[model samples]
Target: MKLHTIDTGFFKLDGGAMFGVVPKAIWNKTNPADDKNLCTWAMRCLLIEDGKRLILIDTGIGNKQDEKFFSHYYLHGNATMDSSLAAKGFHRDDITDVFLTHLHFDHVGGAVIRDGEKLLPAFKNATYWSNRQHWEWAVNPNDREKASFLKDNILPIQQSGRLKFVSAQDGVSFTDDIKIKFAYGHTDAMMLPLINYKGKQVLYMADLLPSAGHVPLPYVMAYDMFPMKTLDERKIYWNEAVEQQYILYMEHDPVNECCTLQQTEKGIRIKDLFKLEEM
Candidate 1:
């Protein structure tokens, strides 16, 4: 199996929202914010080439939204979904599965594309993967998360008859070497893919752990529905990551692509940081 980092681009999000209760004095040291309190973040995606299946995890915020909508989150960078795919000698049609960790606009936006007036699935021949519970929650989003779950980015897959719901069972095998782990704190039933690559396990840190800055226990995102739940989940996973020596594939970290945790006197902290290709 081969894994490639598909960088769609970078966007700015409020640092305060990204670092929950963590003070700016603390988080600023890692993710510095601009005058507007917005910090730049990478909308990094992952491509998995396993035998006959080419699976893509998370489509970074697509370029379909209107000017007014995009003005809110400044999307910048030369890398694009198509360009990144082409770099790997692949195309959108080459993808067999799009495994969405959640339905947030920034994560699933590129799943669909704007074709004139109609919204369509970006991966024409690929089956869009989502879970039943998260699908329902995203479609009928609560007021707090409504803005993040855009209909243009989601409904098209179901409308196109290419959407499939994976089993909600935790640790369920999505493929022979890929297992799905579910976390609820970030959003309802957010799916994290645990992939076995080169005889080692790699955990896709969707929003469960957005960046190395979030390695410390209290650094939960304000966007999480249940911050306390996230804390508990982190404690459990952090220890497992250290014990099992799992490589964490980060989605939103601008500089760091992957990292491993080490047990310290305080708690679990990053042992080393490196790119996925280094593996």
Candidate 2:
């Protein structure tokens, strides 16, 4: 099996929201913000190539949103989903499965595209994978998360008859080597893919741990529905990651792509940082 990092480019988000209760003084040291306190973050996606099945995790924010809408989050950078795929000698049609970690606009926006008067699945020949719980939650979103769950990005998959729901069972195998781990704190039933690559494990840190800056225990995101639940989940996963020696594949980290954890006196902290290709 081969894993590739598909960078869909970078966007700016409020550093305070991304870092949660952590003081700007501390978080700024790692993810320094701009004059407006907005920090640039990568909408990094992953491509899993195992034989004929090419699975893509997360789509990043697509280009379908209006200019006014995009004005809010400044999307910059030259890399895009199409360009990144072409670099790997592949195309959108090459993808067999799109495993969404959640239905947030930034994560799943590229799943669909505006085709004139109609919104359509971006990957014409691929099956879009989402869980039943998350599907329901996103369609009928609460006030806080409503802005993130755009109908144009989601409904098209179901409407196109290419959407499939993964079983709600934790640790369920999405494939022979990829196991799905569910975390509820970030959103309802956010799926994290635990992939076995080259005899080692790589955990896709989708919002559960957005970046290397979030390694410390108290660095939960304000966007999380249940911050305390996120804290508990992070603690459990950090300890297990250190014990098992898992390489974390970060989705939002701009500079770092991958990291390893080490148990320290205070708690588990990043042992080393490197790109996925370095693996």
Candidate 3:
């Protein structure tokens, strides 16, 4: 199996929200904020090439949103889903599967597109994968999260009759080399892909660990539905990553694509930072 980094460019989010209760004074050291207190973050995706399947995990915030909508996020950068796929010698139609961690706009928006009068699945030939729990949670979102779960980005896959659900059972195998690990704090049943590649285990850190700076405990995001649940989940995942020597593939880290954890004197912290290709 081969994995490729699919960069979908960067967007600015309020640093305070991203860092949660952590003081700007501390987080600023790593993810420095602009005058607006927003920090740039990457909408990094991953591509898995395993024989007949070409699975693209988490499409970034799409281009279909209007100017006013996009003006709020301050999206920037040269990399895009199409361009990134082209760079890898593939195209959207070539993807056999679109595995979404969750249905948050920034993560699943690119799964659908606006074509004239119709909103449709971006990858016409691919089956979109999401869990039943997450699918129900997103479509019927609460007030706090409704903003993040846009209907246009979602419903289309189901409308297209191409949406499929992965079993929410934790550690369920998505393929011979990929296993789905479920987390609920960030969003209900967010599925992280635990992939066995090149004699190493690479766990896709969806919203669980957005960046290297979030390695430390208590650095949870305000966007999480249940912050305390997130804290507990992190403790388990972080330790497992360290014990198993898992290379965490980050999705929102602006600079670092991957990181390894170490049980330091101060607790589990980043042992090293590198790109996916470095492995």
Off by over 4 Å in 3: none
Q: Compared to the true structure, candidate 2 yields what TM-score?
A: 0.99
Clashing pairs in 3: none
**Cα error, candidate 3, residue 145 (Å):** 0.6
Candidate 1 similarity to native, TM-score:
0.99
1-279 per-residue lDDT for model 3 (tens digits): 889999999999999999999999999999999999999999999999999999999999999999999999999999999999999999999999999999999999999999998999999899999999999999999999999999999998899999999899999999999999989899999999999999999999999999999989999999999999999999999999989999999999999999999998999999999999999
Residues 52-171 of candidate 1 have per-residue lDDT tens digits of 999999999998999999999999999999999999999999999999999999999999998898998999999999999999999999999999999889998899999999999999
Instruction: Please write out the lDDT profile of model 2 over residues 103-184, one tens digit for every residue.
Output: 9999999999988999999999899999999999999999999999999999888999999999978999999999999999
User: Residue 237 of candidate 1: its Cα lDDT?
Assistant: 93
Rate residue 76 of model 1 by lDDT. 95
Q: Where does candidate 2 stray beyond 4 Å?
A: none
Which candidate order results from sorting by lDDT in descending order? 3, 2, 1
* 149: Cα error in model 3, Å: 0.5
